[model samples]
Structures are given as structure tokens and as C-alpha cells.
Target: MLHLVTGHAGFIGFHTACRLLERGDGVIGLDNLNDYYDPALKQARLAALQALATRTGGFYRDVRANLADAAAVDAVFAQHRIERVINLAAQAGVRYSLQNPRAYVESNISGFVNLLEACRHHGVGHLSYASTSSVYGASTALPYSEHVAADHPLQFYAATKRANELMAHAYSHLYRLPTTGLRFFTVYGPWGRPDMAPFLFTRAILEGRPIQLFNHGRHSRDFTYVGDIVEGVLRASDRPAAPDPAWTSAAPDPARSNAPWRVYNLGASAPVALVDFIDALEAAIGKPAIRELAPLQPGDVPDTAADTTGLQADVGYAPATPLREGVQRFVDWYRGFYKV
Candidate 1:
């Protein structure tokens, strides 16, 4: 399979691309490699991908460009015979969305439309994109299910992702495009984002710095490991969405469509409390964090858990990596990578 994986240098994207390459699939990676966090980390991930491609004898092309650039996106499609698209690109931070709403609009909304247009014109067989469990905002639902109405987004970041879902549905309905939206819960593992809790907590603990605990460390998250996520992504992408036979317009299901569109929540289906997760990190790293408990920041949720049954039923998605083991792996990677 030949895939166009946007944001291929990102944490999940890097891992996803690597898995596809290892399986002998051609991957065309598109990433602007912006300095949203650290460009060096993105570069390192790109370097790793290049090395993997060389070692595995898989076709891999790194294209440095932003999705917001329509000409650039169209040019890529014009150049490559892309069959599938895995969109992992977006301005990802919730708090950052609050501070710079324009960035979200540009990257998440405008850039997404560009890709959608390209897919529609290029006759792409399947399009799988990253959504978020945060789309279950304002709904104090314990297990975030795809069938539930996710119209209310608490933050700009989530709103943009929800907009992507709606946009995909429109394209799917109008053009008969096959689209799958994977709503990810809190994801953590090796090469995870530095801005996320696991990386932040690990780095702070290693440096003996204070680690901020939001919502007074009371929130729980269904933290899925990267390997499991990549597996789910590939499986769902391999099975392009089709018009749900059980779908009805009279009473629509938010997760399925009369069109070739489907949405599923991807996670471990097990939520761990923030403090307990911290304890796991401490155990993995052999260090204690200088904890600084604080109120939940704006645009942040108190708790998040995923109802992963939708993906399970559709694509046999089962995320079984235990939290402790995943944390240990991440800690080991962090220490080795940073020479800590």
C-alpha cells in the first residue's frame, strides 16, 4: 500500500509511519517540522524514519511542507500515486489553542480542507484521520462513546477536530469518499510529545524540578500506548469505511453514516488517575517528582475515558498494553535519548 501520512514526524505519526514501512509499504511523509515544541525532536524522528527506510528497504519520502499550503498538497498528489491518507497533522495543544486560536483555524481547519480536497480529486481509496476524545467535551460522560452526540467541544482545539469530522462526513456523503475518524484518548509512550503529562512529569522528576498537577491531580485518563494506537490506525485504515447497513436518517447515529463515513474511539478502555500514573512514572524512573498541585487549566477536562468497543467491533481493535509496562518503556527511552 502507498500511503500519504501527514504529520509523519509527530509522536504518533512517526511510529505509525515506521510500522507501515516495516511491513514493506511505501510511505510519503508530509510534515512542516514546525517549532511548536522542539524542531530538533521532530528532526530526530525524521532521521530515524530515514534510517528505518534504508534498513528495511521500504519506500519512504520525506516532504517538508504544511497542509495549509494548497498548492503544496496538490503538488504532492500530482506527483505520487497516493492510495490512502492518514492525517495526523494539527496544532495539537489545548491550552495553546486558547492562546493562539488562529493557529488552530489555519492548521486544523484550513489545512484539513486542503487534504480533503486533494483526496477527493486524487481518488484516494481510504482516508483515516486523528480526532480526539476531547470532542466528548461538555458531556460529563464516563466512557466517551462514538455514538454519543459530540457537538459540544469545551475548547478551540477540540472544536477544530470536531469540525474535521463534520467536514469528512460532508465529503464522504457528497463524493462517496471512504473516511474513518479515530478519536484518540490520552496517548503516551516512547517518543511521546514533550508537552504531554508523561514526558513533562518524567523530565521534571529526572531534573528534580516541580511537576504541575492539574485539577489537583484528581483527573483520570485512558492513556493508550503508541504501539496499540498504530495497530488500530493501520487496521482501521486497511478497512475503508462503508455505508453502515444499519444506518438511518430519521434517527442518525453520530458514529456511523449513510455515507461511507465511520468514527471510533481508540484507547485502552482503562483510565488511570493522574496521581497513580505519576506513581508509575516514579517507579519506572526511580525518582520522586516535586509535585505542584494546581487547579485544572482552562480548556482542560477533569477526566477522560474511551469506550473502545466501536473500534473493537469494527476492526478488532484491542489496546492491551498495561500502564506500568508502557511507562517503564517510555522512561527507559527518555533516559537513553536524553542521556539522563
Candidate 2:
């Protein structure tokens, strides 16, 4: 199968594209190589993909283009025999969104609209896109379920992701496009974004700096591994969404629709405390972190737990990596990559 993977140089996109190439799927990767975190790291990921493709004798062509450009997206669709699309490109960061809300609008909203338009016109078979767990914003619910209403988004980033879900649903309903949205929960592992907790904590700990614990170490997150995330993503992409026979408008489930569209939580289903996660990182690095407990930042949720039953039932998605093991793997890669 020929796969069109946006943001192929990103952490999750790199891993997914590598796996697809390893499995003999030809991949055309699209990425702008934006300096959201570090363009060097993104370049390194792209280089690694090229090396992997050469070794495997599989096709991995990368096109440097922004998803916000409608003509660029359309050009790629017109050029390639694209069977499926994995939309992972976005301006990804809750705090960053506060500083530059326009970036979110341009990338997450406008960019997603361009991709949807290309998919609609190109007759793509399955459209799988990345949605964040942050969409379950300000909810006091313990285990976030897909069926629950997600109308309340705390941050602009979350709002844009939620808007993507709605837009995808519209495309699916209007054009019979098979669309699947995977709400990722606290994804972390090697090659992660520097803005994220795991990478920040690891860097601070290694450099003998104090690590800030938001909400005074009271917050909890699902902390899913990237490998597990890629697995779930691949499975979800393979299974084209279908209309739910049980769906009804009277008591509508937000996760599924009468059209060929669905949303599922891709998470570990186990919430780990912020302090515990820090301890795991410390253990992995063989160093103790200097902690500075702080109040929770605005647009930040206190806790998050995923109800992955819907994903499990639909696509056999089960996150199998343990927190300690996953943290160890990340620490190993971080040390090797940074030469720390």
C-alpha cells in the first residue's frame, strides 16, 4: 500500500513511517521541517528514515511542504497514488498555543481543512489523523471516554483538535470518506518533543537542574509509549471506519456516527502520578532530580486517564509497554542521542 504521512519528520510520524516502510509499504512523507522545537532533531529523524529506507529497499520520498498550503497538499495527492493518509502534522503544544494562537489556527485548523479537501477529492480510502487527549479539557471525569461530550476545550490547541474531529466527521458524512480520529494520551518515548514533560524532565535531570512539577506534583497522565501509539495508529489506519448500526441521533455517541467515521482513545488506560513518572525517569538516568513544585498553569488539566475500550474493540488497540520500561528506553535513547 502507498501511504501519505504528513509530519513524517516528527517524533510519532518518523516512527510510524519507519514501521510502514519496514513492512514493505511505500511511503511519501510530507513535512515542512518547522523549528517548533529543534529543526536539527527533525532533520536527524528524516536522515534516519532515509537510511532505513535504503536498508530495507523500500520507497520513502519526502516532500517539504506545509499542510496549510492547500495547493501543496492537492499537488501531492495528484502526484501520488495515495491509498491512505496519516495526518500527524500540527502546531503541537498546549503552552505554545497560548503564546502563538495563530499558529494553531493556521496549522491545526487550516492545515487540516486542506488535508480533508485533498482526501475528499483524491478518493483516499482511509483517513487517519492525530487528535490529542487534551480535548478532554476541564472535565472532572476519571477515565476519559470517547462517548462523552467534548464541547468544552480549555486551550486553543485542544479546541483546534476538537474542530478537526468535527470537520472530519463532516467530510465523512458528506463524501462517504472513511475517517478515523485517534485521541492520543500523553504520548512519550525517544525522539519526543522537547516541550513535553518527559523530554524536559530528562534534560533538566541530566543537566543537574531543578525540574518544575506542575500542580505541585499532583497531576496525573496516561504516559503512553510512542511504540504503542504507532501500533494503534497503524491498526486504526488499516481498518476503515464504518457506520455504527447502534448509532442513533436521540442519544448520540460522540465517538461514532451513522456515517463512516469514528473516534477512539489511544492510551495506556493507566494513569501515572507526576511524581512517580519523575522517579522512573530519575531511576532510568541514575540521577536524582531537584524538584520545584509549582501551581498548575492555565489551560492545563490536573489529571487525564484514557478509556481505550472503544479502540480495543474497534481496532484491537492495546498499549503493552510498561511505564518503567518505556522510560528506560527513552532515557537510553536520550543519553545516546545527546551524548550526555
Candidate 3:
């Protein structure tokens, strides 16, 4: 089977693409390689994919274009029989959204609509896009479930992702397009984003710099491993969503629709506290961290947990990597990748 994986050089995207290629599936990787964190890291990931594809004799093609460019997006669809799509491309980063909301609209909102249109027209079987746990903003509920209404989003990034889910639902209803929105909880593992806490804390500890503990070291996150996430993505992509026959407008479920649309939380379902997470990192890196406490930043949540019951039911699995084990693997890769 051939697949189009947007943002294939991204942390999760890189892993997902590698897995697909490893399994002997043809892959078309599309990435803008923006300087979101560091294009160097993305480039390294791209080079790695190139080498792996060559070594494994797996079909691989890389396309460099922004999804916001409708012409570029259409050209891709016109060129290839992209059977499945994994939409991981987005202007990610919660804090940055405050400074530049337009970037979010251009990429997250517009780019997504472009993909939806292409999928609707091209008869793509399934499109699984990235969503986030931040959509459950201002809700004190523990282990956020997809069934509940996520009407309050604290940041523009979350709002855009929520919009993607809603927009996908419309296409599913009208055109019978199959779509899945994965609401990932604090994913941390090898090739993780530098802006996230795992990378920041790991870098700071190794460099003897102080790592700031947001929410005064009390924040907890369901830090799912990248490998586990990739597994879940593949499973979901292989299974097209079906209309929930029991769904009704009068008593609607936000996660399931009468259309061929569904949303599931892809997480470990095990939240680790910040202090404990740092401790695990220190142990893995064999170095002590200089700790600093800081107040919670805007658009930041004190805690986040995922209700992965729906994910397990649909995909037949959930994230299961242990925190210490995953952190160790990340540190090992960091040392090798950066020679630190």
C-alpha cells in the first residue's frame, strides 16, 4: 500500500514513516522542513529515512512543499495514488501561537482544508490527522475523554486542531470520507521536539544549566513514547472509520459521528509528574540537574491525562512504554545524534 505522510521529518512523523518503510509499504514523504525548532534536526531525520529506504529496499519519495500552497498540494494528489494520508504537518507550539496566530491559520486551518478537499476528490481511503490533548482546556477533568465536549480551548493552536476535527466531520458526512483525529498526550521519546520539556530538561541537565520546572514541579503529563504512538498511528490508518450507528443529534457524542468520523486519544494513560520525570532523566543521563521553579506559563495546563479506552477498543492497542525505559532510549539517541 502507498501512503502520503505529511511532516514525515517530524519527530512522530519520522518514526511513523520508518515503521511503514520497514514493513515494505511505499511511502511518499511531504515536509516543508520549516525552522520550527531546528531544520537541522529535521534534515538529519530526512537523511536517516533516505538511508533506511535504500538499505531496506523500500519505496520512498520525498517532496518539499508547504501544505498551505493549494497548488502544491493538488499537484501531489494529481501525481500519485496516495491511498492513505497521515496529516502530522502543522505550525506546532502552544506559546508561539500567541505571537503569530496567522501562521496557525495558514498551516493548520488552511492546509488541513486543502488536504480534506484533495482526499474528498481523490477518493483517498483514510486520513488520520494529528490533534492534541490541549483541546480539553479549562476542564479540570482528569483523564480527558473524547466523548466530552472540548468547547474551550485556551490557545489558538488548540482551537485550530479542534477546527480540524470539526472540518473533517463535515467532509465525512457529506462526501463519505473516512477521517480520524488522534489527540496525543505529551509524547516524549527519541527525536522529540526541542521545545518540549523532555528535550529541554535533558539538554539542560547534560549541559549543567538549570531546567525550569513549570507549575512549580507539580505538572504531570501522559508522556507517551514515540514508538508506541507510531504503532497506534499505523493501526488506525489501516482501519477506516465507520459511522456510529447508534449516534444521534439529540444525544450526540463529540468523539463519534453518524458520519465516517472518529476521534481517539492516543496516550500511555499514565501521567508522570514533572519532578519524577526529571529524576528519571537524571538517572538515565547519569547527571544531576540544576533545578529552578517557575509559575505556570500562559496556555499551559497543570496536568494532562488521556483516556485511551477508545483507542484500545478501535486500534486493539494503547501506548505502553515505561517512562524510565523511554527516557533512557531518548538519552542514548541524543548522545549519538548530537555527540553530546
Q: Which residue pairs overlap in candidate 2's backbone?
A: none
Model 2: per-residue lDDT, tens digit, 1-340? Answer: 9999999999999999999999999999999998888899999999999999999999889999999999999999999989999999999999999999999999999999999999999999999999999998988887999999998899999999999999999999999999999999999999998889999999999999999998999999999999999999999999999999899999999999999999999999999999999999989999999999999999999999999999898778888999999999999999999999
How would the candidate models be sorted by lDDT, starting from the highest?
A: 2, 1, 3
Model 1 global lDDT (CA atoms, 0 to 1): 0.94
**Model 2 deviation from native, Cα RMSD in Å:** 0.6
Q: Which stretches of candidate 3 lie over 4 Å from their true place?
A: none
Question: Candidate 2 — which residues are off by over 4 angstroms?
Answer: none
Query: With candidate 3 superimposed using the best TM-score fit, by how many Å does residue 313's alpha carbon deviate from the native?
Result: 1.0
Worst 10 residues of 2 by lDDT: 310-319
lDDT (tens digit, per residue) of candidate 1 on 150-181 = 98899999999999999999999999999999
For candidate 3, lDDT tens digit of each residue in 1-340?
9999999999999999999999999999999999878999999999999999999999999999999999899999999999999999999999999999999999999999999999989999999999999999999899899999998999999999999999999999999999999998888899999998899988888899998987888899888999999988999999999999999999999999999999999999999888999989999999999999999999998999989899898879766688999999999999988899
Residue 56 displacement in candidate 3 (angstroms): 1.2
Residue 34 local lDDT, model 2: 89
Local distance difference test scores for all models: 0.94, 0.95, 0.93
Candidate 3 Cα deviation (angstroms), residue 283 = 0.2
Q: For model 1, what is the error of residue 27's alpha carbon versus the real structure, in angstroms, after optimal superposition?
A: 0.2
